[model samples]
Target: MSKNSIQIFDTTLRDGEQVPGCKLNTEQKLRIAKQLDLLGVDVIEAGFPMSSPGDFKSVEAISKLVKNATVCALTRANKKDIEVAAKALKHAKKPRIHTGIGTSDSHIIHKFNTTREKVIERAIEAVSYAKTFVDDVEFYAEDAGRTDNDFLAKVCEAVIEAGATVLNIPDTTGYCLPNEYGAKIKYLVDHVKGIENVIISCHCHNDLGMATANAIAGIQNGARQIECTINGIGERAGNTALEEVVMILKQHSNMNLDTNVNTKLLNYTSQLVQQSMGMYVQPNKAIVGENAFAHSSGIHQDGVIKNRETYEIINPEDVGVSKSSIILTARSGRAALAYRAKNVGYDLTKIELDVLYPEFLKYADTQKEVNDQDLHQLLSSKDNFKKSVNF
Candidate 1:
């Protein structure tokens, strides 16, 4: 409820690790936790303790080393889960136990086979139990996106009274559109009692490709905390990419929200997570993607060559990316070709260049890229490059 700061709760090691084959070892999780601390996240949901012994160890190890952020452990709405989550987070300078239950009728009926009143009761009991071990208790309404508005408000009110310091509204299935998600947060803001005293958070997935949009929308609707992951890795499509959401709040004045993340560490942290998961980042992935700054078009490459800002809204350096890359390809313009050639110490006359371009095209097609060494060899040989000088 603080008007001055927006909290970023990074769930990369917890919910993100739930993605198939994305599980990280304790050392890896600790490495990520250290990085997250440096990145300045308000909280790091280290892992779900009851999932496995490995996960419990990860949460415990991370809890020991995390200094700047509140080290948190996730739990279900049960005492055993809350106790395990508490033990895993016992070593933290600041610890938070994030406990929750499903609130939607669909989840209550199909998932838990319980009634709405029982769902609210379980949520209150979970928070009350978690508060026994940690002063910071965050309660989530799993599948809140599909829950009835009035029932969701009622759940939030009851949980706040039960000592929940933060209320996380998760779009577990990523079913809400941006506007709908925003309205959900706004509704809670208006209706939930003591909502101003407890932090409101967003946990959106990318099933409909709107996770980040929904997260931003939640911010606009007065939610101060965003629960997201690196590269959007999660259960299904993924959660909101923390990099995108942080930068969105940073670069856009319309959403004057701000997070504690050090934008410079984003790319490295992303790579760490990717490497730990044994998955490569898609080339076109935003922010940390290999092609995020790679330009293949003629006009765009030319502009990027002259001024990166002309083609890129974000400075590559802001996300630990070095600079824009002017990649020469079939679509590359003369300016890019010339610039690249010059980097390798070639200064061909327009007339000479016109003759050699054919060979360049042939080589370029065979390889993914044209390098300086190949260009040098072709230009050095007068036998291939020379012609009747007529320009």
Candidate 2:
């Protein structure tokens, strides 16, 4: 991989499916997994093989089906989970076992009921065991967002020494600010021994809606791989969105960071996941949302009609969208009205537009949106509008 290239590790099939009511059958999982591989993701976290028989089958099937991307299976820091994950991934051209234990004090004491020393031992044991099965092993310090930097550095160094090829520092609870998360990654980069040999990965959650920011910060500091999901689907609020981070890196070329993702397939992949999982993306959601390219406000519409870059940072076609939508609402201006009017074959002159503007506003005010049919009716309903029509 190039120094500036970021590895996109998509866990959509696993973490994304964790959302309540977003479950997918094996067939659906296969469909989405194929799309993800085609979308140029570096790794696909197929599923947690030990979670259930169905998940194991899905992971096994995906391992065989995926040709290019490394098929990864998630596991806790244990031999049994690592064994199951390895069995499921035996057919993969390139397989990865992702295993780790929680390192945060909250998780160590409250969740694992263990001391930090024991937690580090389990982390090392899991990575070493996983290494025996797959050459590419990723160790995650679960809830590393809150893990002490000194202790987190120790865990990372131990895993790297234990043959872990990747270290995933996850903001499991989505609690860190971007600066803090970046500093944590920097601390690991500076403090951990032999860290230069393995890739640093970021796995941030969206409980506080800062997952994207935190993931960006991680990469800026030292992380190379970003674990994300399509449409940001996951447990609780969700994980960092795949599309958002991909586009952010692309748009900010000064950062000198890019990903393998095919920029155009973002919307199509998002729709595929949404349909397969039946999870609805909010209209205003970033990147692949319905309104991402839609212009509704009058000032915005006018600016966009003149030049798309005036209001849109991204071209609609770049992400598989056909065109930008110039939605006509009461807030729409004369320029937007004339632009929409021209699309429906009106081609109204300035004088004609002036005459029709009041009537259009009257109709637009009564309705949420004024479409082509509405404009046709509005123009034909009155003799004055009929006279004003260029036709």
Candidate 3:
């Protein structure tokens, strides 16, 4: 891996499918998995093999189909789950068994009904057991965002020592602010023994709409891997979006991080997931959204027309948008009106445009937006004008 290259650990099939109405069949999972492999993600978390037979089959099929990316199967920190995940990944060229347990006090006391020492023991034992199946094992500290730093460091150190190749610190409930999440990752990097040997991964949720921010903070602090999904689809308000994080690193080169993702395929991948899962990406969602590069306001359209960089940070083609859209609404300026007119096979001069602008506004006021046909009619009306009589 390059010194500044971040590893994209995509969990779309496992986590993204957890949405209530987004369940996908094994064939759909395989299709998305193939696209993800081409998209250049480092690891594809196929599914939790122990969850059900259908999940196991999805993992197995994805393991067989994916050629470039490592196929990973999720598991609980226990014997049965680890065994099932190993079986599901038996045919993978590069296979990983991702197993972990809850680390936070709330999860330990309420969710597991176990003590802290016992939880740590289970974590170590799970990693050691998983190492027997495959050399690559990822240990997740579920809900580590709220876990005490000292205890979290202890668990990280123990897992790294026990043959785990990756340590995942998840903001399970999206409770931490960016500063807080960065501090947590920094603490683990400073305090955990043998931490430099393993990859530090960040898995964040979007309950507070900060998943992308928190993921960036983690990378800036110390994390090298981001566990994200297409369109940020996942359990409970979704997870960090792969498109947003990748583009953020690309646009803000000052961050000094890069991912292997072929950014041009981002929009295509998002659309595939949306169509397969039957959950539409919100029109205003970031990065791959319909309005992501669309300019409608007069000031914004004028700035974009003059120079796209004035208002748009990233190029539409950079993410497979083909071209930016200048939507003609009541608020659209004359520049946008002319721009759209030229595209529609009309070249109106300033004099003709000045005559047409008022009528355009009047028509725009009566509708939501002015389409090409609408603009054509407005221009045609002027062409049919009769000569003025000077008698």
Best by TM-score: 2
**TM-score: model 1 vs. ground truth:** 0.94
Give me the displacement of residue 206 in model 3, in angstroms: 0.7
Clashes of 1: 0
Cα-based TM-score, every candidate: 0.94, 0.98, 0.97
Model 1, runs deviating above 4 Å: 1-4, 348-352, 382-391
Error of 2 at 312 (Å): 0.7
Top candidate when judged by lDDT against the true structure: 2
Question: Would you list the C-alpha lDDT of every candidate in the order shown?
Answer: 0.87, 0.94, 0.93
The per-prediction CA RMSD against the true structure, in angstroms, equals: 2.6, 1.0, 2.7
Q: How far is candidate 3 from the true structure (C-alpha RMSD, Å)?
A: 2.7
- Model 2 TM-score is 0.98
> Candidate 2, residues 1-391: lDDT per residue as tens digits?
7889999999999999988998899999999999999999999999999999999999999999999999999999988999999999999999999999999999999998999999989988999999898899999999999999999999998899999999999999999999999999999999999988999999999999999999999999999999999999999999999999999999999999999899899999999999998888999999888999999898998889888999899988889999999999999999999998889988888987888899889888899999999988876777866776765
- Which pairs of residues clash in candidate 3, taking residues 3 or more apart in a chain or in different chains? none
Clashing pairs in 1: none
Candidate 2 backbone collisions, by pair: none
